[model samples]
Target: MKTPLSRLGNSGLETSLLGLGTVKFGRNAGVKYPSAFELPDDKSLASLLSLAADLGINVLDTAPAYGSSEERLGQLLKGQRHDWIISTKTGETFDGKNSAFDFSAEATRQSVERSLKRLKTDYLDIVMVHSDGNDLELIERNEVIATLDQLKQEGKIRQTGFSGKTLEGALAALKQVDMLMLTYNLREHREGEAIDQANHLGKGVYIKKAFASGHLVSGSGEEGQLSSFRHILGKAGISSIIVGTINPDHLKQNVRALCQASAGMV
Candidate 1:
């Protein structure tokens, strides 16, 4: 089944209900997923993207901290740029062995510029500030949101947002940006109120770690995955759920699960 598109709040952008997360595409050294894995080769990566596109999944999430993900996608999606909605992050960088964050206005600008070159795109659909658990501090101390806003105005990015961890940070981000990428899975729901608020305000809310970072899987197999998808995607506030599974079969299962989950809701 093909994933359907939905309006991303008031950003005037439309993305699929399921977004493919690309962390495993570039960095696997210090990830927090269930297990360590190897990065896909160019051919495998191209195949995965092709399957996603054929399934009608439009959004792809990447970040500077995700190592070479942006560059690889830039190369693979060369002639198919318009086929996907690219969502990447700023404020964090990975140097193969470690991650360093800089939320300064200058850094934010430089990060977006670098991402543009790496992704081989003239304008990004959405640019989110990757929070390091210090959501509020990142917004107030640095030019993270402001720089994104400027970029939006300059037409470099269509929208600005924050992938925050705390409720307060999410709320603050709601007031200043077009979207909020928050963690709201079976294991955590503290951001529930924030999600509702974003819905009411017409701001996009994309869910991260909807399966609790791969720890919420149950013996129900595909049914378990469908349940998790229903729990979050069934909510009216969510724009999309970002799942990072490199295995094509897993990706197909996720899309099918989402289809079943949404179907059951009706």
Candidate 2:
């Protein structure tokens, strides 16, 4: 069965309950997955995306920090562009093994433009700030939210938000943007209050690290995986849970889990 699509808060974007994260499509250098692996070749990535589409996933989450992920998606999703909701980020970049941050208004605008060029799209569906732990400072001091708002006004992005690390930041961001992406998983529920607040305000919420950053995934059995997914996706405010993978089997399994969890909801 195909996974169901839902309105992402009040952003007017319809996305699958499960969104595909594209970090593995472009980088694996500084990740903390249980094991180190080579980046998937183009052929493999194409197959993975095909499977995702077949399973009814419509959101693809990427960022400038994810190495060449945006570039690869631009190339591979050219003909199928209209079929997916492309979400990328600004404010951060990955240099093979280390990461860097820039939240200046100029850098934020430049990042969006660069992402547009790399994704081969004239406009992005969503562009979020990829925060480096200074979520509040980035918004209040650096004016990242204002910059994204300006870009949205300029027709460069359809929706805007931040992948915030702090609850205070997420809450503050909810008042300013159309969406908020945060870490929420079985192991961590600190963002639950923030999610509820976003939902109350009719703003979109995207869940990241639902599998505990791969540590729980590595340790969990099949039943354990199902329980974790059910708990996470059962929450009310989540527009989608973003999971990154280049493996077809994992993608299929994730879709199945989402289907099962959703069934329980209905």
Candidate 2 backbone overlaps, count: 0
Candidate 2: residue pairs that collide? none
TM-score of the candidate numbered 1?
Answer: 0.96
lDDT of 2 by residue, 90-144 (tens): 9999899888899998999899999999999888999998988877777888977
Clashing pairs in 1: none
Q: Model 1, residue 71: displacement in angstroms?
A: 0.5
User: What overall lDDT goes with each candidate model?
Assistant: 0.88, 0.86
lDDT of 1 by residue, 1-266 (tens): 89767778977788888999999999988888877788999999999999999998999999999989999999999999988889999999989998899999999999999999999999999899999999888888887888888999899998888898899999988899888898888778898899899999999888988887777763458876888988886578678889987889989999888888877452
Clash totals for all candidate models: 0, 0
Span of ten consecutive residues with least summed lDDT in model 1: 211-220
Q: Locate the minimum summed-lDDT window of 10 residues in model 2.
A: 216-225
How high is the lDDT of residue 56 in model 2?
94
Q: What TM-score do all the candidates reach, one by one?
A: 0.96, 0.97
Question: How many angstroms is residue 18 displaced in model 1 relative to the true structure, after the best TM-score fit?
Answer: 0.7
Cα error, candidate 1, residue 101 (Å): 1.0
Superposed model 1: Cα runs more than 4 Å off: 218-220, 264-266
Per-model root-mean-square deviation over C-alphas: 1.3, 1.1
